[model samples]
Target: MNNNLQLYNTLSRSKEKFEPLNPPNVGMYVCGPTVYGDAHLGHARPAITFDIVFRYLMHLDYKVRYVRNITDVGHLENDADEGEDKIAKKARLEELEPMEVVKHFTDRYHKNMDQLNVLHPSIEPTASGHIIEQIELIKSILDNGYAYESEGSVYFDVKKYSNDYDYGKLSGRKLDDLLENTRTLTGQQEKKNSYDFALWKKTDPKHLMHWPSPWSEGYPGWHLECSAMGAKYLGETFDIHGGGMDLLFPHHESEIAQSNACRGHDPVHYWMHNNMITIDGQKMGKSLNNFITLDEFFSGKHKALDKAYSPMTIRFFILQAHYRSTVDFSNEALHAAEKGMQKLFNTVELIDKLTPSSNSSVDVQHFKDSLYAAMDDDFNTPIAIAQLFELSKIVNQVNDGKETLTASDILFIQNLYSVFVFEILGLISENIKGNDDQLVDQLMGAILSLRQDAKQNKDWATADKIRDELGKINIKVKDTKEGAVWNIE
Candidate 1:
């Protein structure tokens, strides 16, 4: 199972061989959401993308420690390093404690992820939970002189770290490039350099979520918690770090810079980022005011939605595109995914009930090779799905008796469909849900009970009336195998 798996690492900007720091064991960390609002459609891209990576790695027999963090305390809504916590702002508006806002949104985020069927990570460390670790990291950076105190706050000296490590390695920009256009936002002038970010910020007296720290009565800075908690739990360096493409610049880059500044080593081995979800070529961001929450999509409450889409349909839509390619949301594209997924699930169900023959028509090896190649080439699920459809054609033809499959071929398809569709891809067809003949049984029972009363009155016409009514609901009642069994057409 240890075939050379190729993944497009954002750190190197190429498809490189995925070599975990510890062979057969990988440590992965993704920057989870700053839970202040409901998670939108923009949230599912990176989530399902990494879920596929986790599943496929385990499928290849690797034990992965996937750590995704919760940013309960975050920077300002305007992306200002010195602004008030986003969660804190919500608490003030609702007149509740800051922790209350975190509790509500955190619960909502979990509920949303549950709907997507995204597997829970091995460790979900909260920023507030690891305050000591973050403070310890800032202390180490202070001792190393990579960070300096200003009043009660501490800022990382980005200019100093740039001397050794490339500051914009992940973003593909250099110091001069960022320094030129990195607009001078308010409140960041307190840092040593324009690019320097806060490692610890002194909280105001009115700030609702202040904690005692070495610097002051303050919480960890926006980017410091990831480096500290990651280093504390995973190690100085781990196998993979993943998130949305938006995090490449200041968030992830700052995390790497702060970690290296304190620990004197690079942090992650592989950097994976999933592309954004666009409404109409524009990024569906909060500022754009075009984002749709998962609940809206599920409930069909959005103005653009014709009807509610199931969770599996949304997951399928995201998977249909390459992880790095931006997918446009539209009724047509979504409908296509819905039709395509239903066809796939239906074909999977057909495999078990297919009657094997003495001969076979389809080449199972070719389908297997094609599906594996698509997945091995960075988990290309859309193309894998196309291959599934190709197999589906053969399965349906066999069902129609226009084609044939040998016993061995049938078993191969059964295992392939079960593994790829159910186990790995996590789709289930509605065909497996209830008793197969229950619908017809219920319909015919009512009709036949009425017919018995008609016969008791010696009324042939009334008995015939009940039989005709059963025909409308596709109930076909037949007397066979010791008693009458009914089926729906």
Candidate 2:
């Protein structure tokens, strides 16, 4: 289980060699959705990005406990301390209970993730479910003299914490700059400093979500839930903490302050953040009103989409770019990704049918080495995918009888595709459903056999009719020396 993985640490602002706190056992925590609305393309980016991280760590023979939390209770509208709770607002708009709203959106999120082929996390804690832990954490911060209670609300004292620690070390923000730039929003007057953020807020009488605490009958702050839930599951310290780059500011920065203020040290060893998705060179977000939900992309119901994109096509499109790079979505790019995904799937099928010879022509070992090397370099999926494309070319040549492969080489190719494509990259054939694949194959085989019989009997009209009908259904049939091979176009 030799693994030399390098990952970019947003904390240190550089790529560093990955060293887990405990060898063979790693813990990772990622910030999850608030469950107030359907997941969009922006949401898919970090989900798939950290999913690769989780899959690759397991591939390296590490026992990983991955925790991604649901922000069901504390998240507020506009990410402000005084705004309406996002889930509560949505519940009001939909005329449902807050819990009902949470359950509905959470289920939809899971379904979208399932369609995208993302594995479920080892633990999915919800903010509402962990109120006691969050209250305890806030108490600890107050005990440590880094937080204060004012008018039944508790706020983390950014100025007091900064005097004893580098408050903005993770985000490279200075205390003075934060104070100067902090917005003077309504209900912030109670804080000792403008830069101070809430750990727990005293709820309004009409507030839907409230928990009993010594300081107030209110919900935990947005940032406190992750800090409490992560430390509760992964301990006071852990290996990796990942989320979207947009969270690097107040959300994650405040997490750093709250955790360190309680534990007297950083909670995570490595900090990873996936970049945002862009549309027409601008960030696509709900606030921007240009955001497209995952369902909308799948259904092609949005004006921006030219056609419905398969889940695998959306997954491939995201992986085609490096995780840290801004991925711009477009119809042309998605079409190319759909075509490329089909080519890879077709090559894998072709590889299984290629007969082995006494010798090999391609450097299978070199290809394997390059593929792993690309993955090792900060999970450079785009580079690894490029090498897979190269291997696909070799597989195609062998299938065309233009090249030869030994039995061992053929096995190597199959295993490599299984590991890199199916296991690590988490790509599944969109056209092939479980059990349906075998049935489809059996049906296609029967149809193709009927066509072969017609051709053998020189019944040209019947054979032509069968071929034309399959073509109309986007199934291409190719005639070869071995007979006719059918594939979905």
Candidate 3:
């Protein structure tokens, strides 16, 4: 509901103040994983990017209904209209049901998102579950003379639709250039033009997934699902549509065309896209055989990674850069992020223990305003994070007795960190835990007390056995003048 909030709209190619169609109500649709394989670094960027948008809008008191669709079907192997469906191909290769493949990968995808602290969408509709809706959308397009059926398949009249409406406004592609450069591929003979895309594709004998449709026994096209599901869940037009920049060309552009063809108008008010995560100056993707999966990063199982990085580190690394900027992956960058995250957490802890004074040494309102200004200007998380770092320096000064804060200022600082760091940025402290870790620490203290008793009684054998047993499990016990302390090695 904040009128000052601005977002970079890919359609307009500029930052614009976000105004929802309805007051205090926002509808956002983001393109989600295809679930044909393990989620990779490429998948994490957009998820985290939109998670920021989702969190900030809700923080602004907007009743946000975020719809992120799961593409369980109709996403082809080559991202084209003719190739095998990605999930179906995985199923065929693994000798399992297509839905089973979808469930397996989708579960892993969800687990990874949860580890990254990404919030779940309000509604997650699947393409397979919404087959009927896609069929009806195709029917509407055909009725409106924007699509045609050929040899039991339906193709969107892209060349024809371009004449009536702007075809590539989202992607900025020209129809004549597309037609001239678009190479002829297999299974395109039925189309009137080479650039025309499918609304529905006729299933071949070997095609593993299909449903009965009016045109033929087929499945929805790759671009048809988002158009159908976005309109179904968020009305004919919604506030924001988001995805990775790589999808801007064919996937999202076709989505715009499909929506316009059927609904006779634009579907989304704002189009937003997050840039890619690159490795060795190349975009990370599964097809390139150079991408690393989230599992590999967490476990340090990939050859490219120097060591294991926590989920928060990965999330921090992505957020350290603007959502629209390409983030190149490197171990040094991740290590820096890990250190930066720990410093922020340490500052929060220090702020909690700070004693208040009768007078404040700093203007806490300036800090708040700076943070808000960064977010309002296109969700600039890096700048907001910089402000947090500056606040960390101030907190260090107060803790060291070089500065002071009033009781009200201290309370304000606490609430500010809680709202921005935990709620909006979705960062959780790795070293800090809830009651579970407290209980573990207490139990460990009792065990250490028993070892101390053994040492006091001069039972060298028992003390050595206890210490050795603990060592076998990767716990190192250090004895100093203060006392014996144990840590996980």
How badly does each model clash, as a count of residue pairs?
Answer: 0, 0, 0
Query: What is the per-residue lDDT of model 1 for residues 93-126, given as tens digits with 9 covering 90 to 100?
Result: 8988888888888899899888888889899999
Model 2 lDDT on a 0 to 1 scale: 0.90
Top candidate by TM-score: 2
Cα lDDT for residue 457, model 1?
93
State model 3's lDDT: 0.90
lDDT of 2 by residue, 1-489 (tens): 468899999998999999999888999999999788899999999999999999999999999999999989945677545567888877878899999999999999999999999999999999899999999999999999999999899999988898888888889998777777867685689999898888888998667888899997888887898899999999899999999999998888888888899989989999999999999998989878789999999999999899999888999999999999999999999999999999998888778888999999777779888998999999999999999999999988898889899999999999999999999999998654224568788999999999999999999999999999999998888898888987675
The true-structure Cα RMSD of candidate 1 reads 4.8
Q: Provide the lowest-lDDT 10-residue window in model 3.
A: 74-83
User: lDDT tens string, model 3, 368-456?
Assistant: 99999999999999999999999989888888889999888888989999999999999998763333688768877888899999999
Model 3 clashing residue pairs (backbone): none
- For model 3, the superposed segments whose C-alpha errors exceed 4 Å read 79-82, 432-434, 437-439, 443-489
Q: Report the Cα lDDT for residue 118, model 1.
A: 89
Error of 3 at 1 (Å): 3.8
RMSD of each candidate relative to the true structure: 4.8, 2.1, 3.7
